[model samples]
Target chain A: MAERKRRRALLRMGAGISKSARVADRLFLPVVAGAALLTMLLTVFHRQIQEIVSPSPQPSGEQQGPRADVVAYTVDKVPISDPDSPVWDNIPHSRISLADQSIIKPLKLNVPAEPVKVKAAHDGEWIGFLLEWPDSKADTQAIKVKEFRDACAVMITSYPSPPEARFMGTANNPATILHWKADWQIDIEEGFQDLEKAFPNVSVDMYPLLKESIRDGKPPKTVDIPEFARVRLPGTWAGNPVSQLSKASPVEKIVAKGPATITTLPTQDAAGWGRWRDGVWRVVLAKKMKASDGQAGEMVIERGQTYSVAFTVWFGDGGDRGSRKNPSMLHTLYVE
Target chain B: MPKVYNWQIGREMDYWYEESRPRRQAAAVFDTNKCIACQTCTVACKTTWTSGKGQEYMYWNNVETKPWGSYPMGWDVNILKMLGPQRWSLEGERYVYRGKTIFEAAAQSERVLGYLPSDLDYAYPNRGEDETNEIVVEEKFYLRMPHDLWFFYLPRICNHCTYPACLASCPRLSIYKRPEDGIVLVDQARCRGYRECVQACPYKKVFYNHVTRISEKCVLCYPAVEKGIWPRCMRTCIGKIRMFGYLNTPEKADPENPLDFLVHVKKVGLPLLPQLGLEPNIYYIPPIHVGNINFLRMLFGPGVDQAIQTYNKAIAGRDLELVAALLLNVSTDRIMTKFKVIGSSEVAGYDENGHEVVRIPLKEPAVVRPFYDERLQVYRHNIT
Candidate 1:
């Protein structure tokens, strides 16, 4: 009875996992569709499955120019992050957004609840993921007031059971999350614009701290001292501080651990990135196997090892951020 | 989720479902009427703590004109706009805010009806100082029609509220309010510079350090407070405006207790924007320049009328007996918990042990200084 009720509850919860999930904010959801889906998922995944398990869709490599129609289950196959890889032809492609009901009641999510087309690949040394989506606004700028950028993340958990401790993780178990931010990607690609660069025509009085100042009519005054040379003025400092703040240079650096542990990347760990654009965004995130003592479990895909994975997406425009984001349930995957 | 009753919202609000009852909660009182906009407290706070590179645009302690200035360039105006016009109707004796509480509005949202202002917004602290008041034109002839123009100096610091939005917004759960003293702080070791706290704080007190990539705020001089020393802003107040101490529980509240007397017993001090329902620990004696009833109520809640009347009585000696006793320790170096109205014009302050720490008269007599000093090398003391 307890298991039945839990499944029923999960079904009800996952029923309205989209914008239409609100069902006009008063109704719970269309129970019929949810019940049917839940029954099918439960039959296969069993009682322990908290996530909605949907069959993988073939990657619709059909974007601008479609050569032909091809469908393959990539989750069951060896997936790579490279978009050009032949494996991408067979993968899950759908419009997916927030599904969990935890944030739905309170947050009025206003983003494209489209299932982002996902393609995966692994080349022994590295595991890569390619996420492509169509957004009218690229929203790559996140450094301004009220400005939000589009972002996506992935979470991996090796432990099957751990008493449901969620403060990052209990003392014993740890989860590794890899977050990729659009703003960080942009900054990494082209350094954050400085005040002068953002506004070339504007000139103002120079404070004592600025290394290079263009005061009114005088030749640009240069501070000769080395110590003062490194001093960054308030508005003048640009570029993402991740590289400057952490030892990692370039923005969007990956830390293996959860939000609590944002320390340096784990040992022997490496990340590769590729972003394609054509009226939309296609981002590829690839990681290599490595060893680390970091509290955040390392992101290493050992051959024949099964791992549980989840996903999170941040649509900056919809003000989707922090704990106020849509996340997916755990799916088991084994790399070969 | 554990729920706490918020009097301002006139309802119970949900917390993060944790048993986080503090052993002792921190509290403070600020007399905005006495503030002179000297910026002494601002400088003292800056030199003591926020002198680092990334903290240049940050001011944990800032003072601005009531209606004109805000450190982050319209922090109040922006929040008000997001919240729109608030609606409230008195439910019997208590006033219940009809609009969404700051938390409720941002229940599952990323921010608490706030925006993280750009670097330019924080560049100037006094951009609109004294500019919100009516502009008066001087006539050629001396017209006898005298109009009263007023604006109060509003000094701001972290309230370290009972339910800090910053703590609730952090996904990493890095921000923690010390159970011993109730001081809200961000654990540098754990913070990822997510800036969620920066957005969630209604007052925008939490700052993101670009260099180290972490959140830092007014530590409330915890190192000094642990040693029983008052916060630097309170201790160095040239205008003698700020009060610092831990608030006693409702059961332990005594009229003689400084924090209780000003905040509860006398009801002279009120929290800034109680409509937000964070249960802010820091309370303010509303500035008299707040002639607009709605403005007054918006800042201090429906207690505006009562607070102003009570403050007027207390400051004007209508209730001099209790007033003098409460403010006696305004000049004392030692932080006191109790006060006694020993005489008509004099009062004494006592420490936690009931030991007298200071006794000051209603007025201190000033003496003329010597014009010349024997230790002077060349110039006289008075002839600079």
Candidate 2:
């Protein structure tokens, strides 16, 4: 009887182990499924996941355009300087085709479909435009000719089509443009000599055109002295009339019409700021709507008036700059 | 594509496209005889530009063993196979290439001959030519073979051709030869990584950066050139076999200039492949009897034999200025627009503006080291 009881006990123990094993097998599938679901969630909300872990500021979602009648209004309570303001969240959006702008038709296939988000506000004296877009790269620096920087321009023109002007607007239409440059911002934040700092071993002598002396041969050994004045290559050097080397500004006022016709305005009142976060760029451009002495271009905004506005964007990594830029057709802007 | 004239082939050859000439251009020549395959030029170029992500396969400056080696692995062989055997016939002074150029190979809408090389194919560079198997005639004499293992280092860069196929192949018209320097460059803002330029370059020079998704190649170090400095490759050479200068027309070429003297006078430097009709600005001083003569002749056209003979004669005659100019003065930063032999001791180099760049002495400098002596307590020169 004792041996039989012992046998029965052993069988019960074995049965218990088998039952536990079956239970574990049943639970394994759910565990795996849960893990896979978590991974997928993490991938979808990667930006949010980063924020959750780090607990820093988070960028708001994409902005939505306002109704057709809702003109840009003056704001004192909401922040106008910050491009990431929630106030911009209520504004309308326009998705421009930068890819099709390619001169070569076949090249358009590679361009990504993206749109530019914009919002406008005024403090009576200062007019502010907040622009945002998705950019995989920040591209805040450019030192070499091949390296490019992200840039944005806002073209504002007077009503009634003053005269014939190209897309940039002509002297007759007189579009007052506020251009924001990421390169110029970086130049202010750090310096273009950063590349030199990175590649400290590779030193180069300044070019003859960069030198102040009127002679040529070997570059001067010392930094304080000049080696040569300028280079006389056998062709016409048509530099961008609006740009000059060894200088930088976050915002610039320019006017142009047609090719090779851009001229930088003398005004220094415009100011801009830009920041890239989580594959998106937020930019703010602010300038006085009225001229200092009360005389202004036809683009001067007035209450209850309608005006034309155009936009151009350069995706630094997308190879958009100069004439090769994503341009938008004229859009109506109500100055409320 | 329209029929146009190409003078680079030394004849009124037909080109499939019409392109306006650049005002002028910078040119180069490499003396392969002195090359040790150190790859300093390659390393310098990589460090300067191609050291970014997605540029791992790019070698703006490369050196491969001739008749045996090629970058993009088998680029020459592959193209040759596709084009078939190129035949040429001499008509009076001009020789015509019967084979199709990249332009001629393409359809009317296409600007150049384009073939997408598999990504795996770009992995290997400088994969040289296979050797001839030894013949066993009656006995085991492995030494005697007609096509033996003959090879020499052939360093290459962008030809910056008078008629660059890369420039023509770009549908966006972004690639341009600068009117100032004739340096062909793809505008950074205008390019959209189509790899058309990569497909068009017969030399397989232009590389596509997968990360940047754009085409990039040698810029000829224009930034430094504008400053009157030698390109990093020429400046940092282990062999001193490189020369950088401008190519002028026959009427405009400075007679005293080292470039003109070697190209037109001595006839020692020849273009790598003139039959392509691209009129490449880069020149090469053929390797000295080190590789297959017929193969070298095919590449450099008819100039191989004459170039070798002239180089030998110059070396034998102890022509100091020619030798000095060919070797260059490593100690100075002067660009030699022209060279002159001064007496028996030195060769003088001048810049475009009549400024003396360097004065390289034919004789070696004697070193006098000062060492302390225990007994004499006097310093003396130690000559090696």
Candidate 3:
């Protein structure tokens, strides 16, 4: 009688388990179909959903902007400071996201965000980078009051700290900054811009200091003006490198301990050129692999070594300048 | 951001840095009622400091005809538009600004709410010159106190404020305020030609040099001030409308100091746009003849009504101390720290060292000339 009762309970338990399993099997197809529909909708409205979710589009996971790593390929005697060199065609490019600089004083939080395509190459003697970014207008003139010039810079630190450290580095860990300005490129391509060049019809009675250069009842060229007259320009007289009219290269080497302490290195060891074509700026910045003796604030480049590199961009038409810029996070630059 | 007390606004306001007052604030009081707009101060400043290659458009000192005139094409109106509508409330005995300052109204990207002027904006340094509040073509035109149609000359210079917008807005910390005299200046060597100072200054005093590709402004003639002399603009004012002295805070107000007497005791002098929260060192005695109190209020703050009344009393010879203060303007090149009315006829000024710098008769003695000059045998057409 006991054995018969136990058999009856076991049979009831088996029946209940079978019924629930069958029900679950029946619901499985619809659940898969619903999940597929939800995924399709999400993929179709991905951009809209991102806009709703984030104030700024995050450049992550194979986005068109910059990635986390860049490899500097070894090449033999690629033309230094030439963005249009044919060698760039053979090299792979990495896209860099231009992040808004919202961490510092006089921040530029709203940037015309875009991806900057970059290619890095190095011979044994020199390391160079070619950066290409989009800008609707070519603003190469900063001589006017409201005009600011398009510019880009590359910062290379020792990569001694974590990636979360200051992009420009701190006082203890200094970074070497190579800045290329469009206005400086213009100065090299064309002659130095002066007040007379900006306003063709501007007239003045006389610049008494420039009397020695004035002739034929016409104003003298900026180059013709003597040193005595140039002293009147307090910036130039005070040895400010930014105010210097003549330049052998468009790029200037600057040393910085964070944003507030950016000073142009007296011995500039960088060279660059920038060209704006078809609403895009392609710039090449080059630096020596090793600094000459007594050359201060220069980063030494070496092969088979990794260095942390970052980028900063300024869109001139948007009035981007100084601490107002778009900066990127640190990326490992492998010099192979 | 730190909150600092702005005595001009009679309230605490947001500032980039902490409250740091100079040892002796270099101050000046301009009697707008007496200014003739001869451009003497402008020329003096031009020849003294800004006569250079890239400084053609710079005017450290400029006198504009008010109600429509601006040196940099709508500098005041443009900033005012950005600042939007502001209000000043009379709380107890002081007027408190209940509006946002340039620093407070700034966008997230900037330290101050500012706009960069175009090159053409400075092309017309004297645009709307001599223009009145409105067209004066009524058939029956009559002059009255606070006239139906009125205009006055407004001379401007760098205020060298206690909290300078230029100094606050500099990203690289190129601009500084001197600890000795509160004179704000741009260190040319450190400036990278960003022109942030040019955009930040509310008065549009900071100027950008096209040739040099850097920004420059009025230096307040520190070289002259270091030697206890007045700035070129103040000393060369032909109208005798400017008084240079060391001003103290209201709590440390010196009754005998000319700037303190005019600014604190009599309250005849008022700061330009005190709502901006710069605590500007320069003060202007409002024009009593201008009819629109609202217009005056916008430029000189809520103190215009009382300032005009006090100015009218001083002009009427009812206020001897105020009259003596005005008489001492341009009396000597030395910066006068103290002044006194000498009896009924004379006023005396003392320099920083307590030495009497100047003594001038309040009223010049006039002698009538004969109708015909006996020596030249000619009839005098004009006689004083």
Instruction: Output the number of the DockQ-best candidate.
Output: 3
Q: Write the per-residue lDDT of candidate 2 for residues A31-138, one digit (tens) a residue.
A: 999999999998878954553233221122433224221245667633534677776665654443332343322222244467676667776777777777788999
Give the DockQ-based CAPRI class for model 3: medium
Q: Please report how far candidate 3 places residue B368 from its true position, in Å.
A: 4.1
Highest TM-score among the candidates is held by which one? 3
User: How much is B341 displaced in model 1, in angstroms?
Assistant: 3.5
By summed lDDT, which 10 consecutive residues of candidate 3 chain B come out lowest? Answer: B137-146
Clashing pairs in model 3?
A66-A95, A66-A96, A66-A97
User: Candidate 3 — which residues are off by over 4 angstroms?
Assistant: A1-68, A212-222, A293-296, B368-383
Strongest candidate by lDDT = 3
Candidate 3 lDDT over B1-384, as tens digits, reads 999999999989999999999999999999898999999999999988787767889998999999898988898999999999999898998888999999999987689989888877888988878888889877525878888788899999999999999999998899999999999998888898898999999999999887778889999999999999999999988899999989999999988899999999999889998888899989999998888899989999999989888878877889877888888888899988889889989999998789998998888888889999999999998878
In order, candidate lDDTs are 0.62, 0.64, 0.84
True contacts kept of each: 0.21, 0.01, 0.78
Q: Which whole-number lDDT from 0 to 100 does residue A222 have in model 3?
A: 38
Task: Kindly list the per-residue Cα lDDT of model 1 for residues B265-380, writing each as its tens digit.
Answer: 77777888887868888888887645466777887788778878887776676887546744653467566788877657677877777888888876555666556555764545
Candidate 2: where are CA atoms >4 Å away? A1-336, B1-5, B13-19, B93-99, B129-148, B318-321, B329-333, B363-384
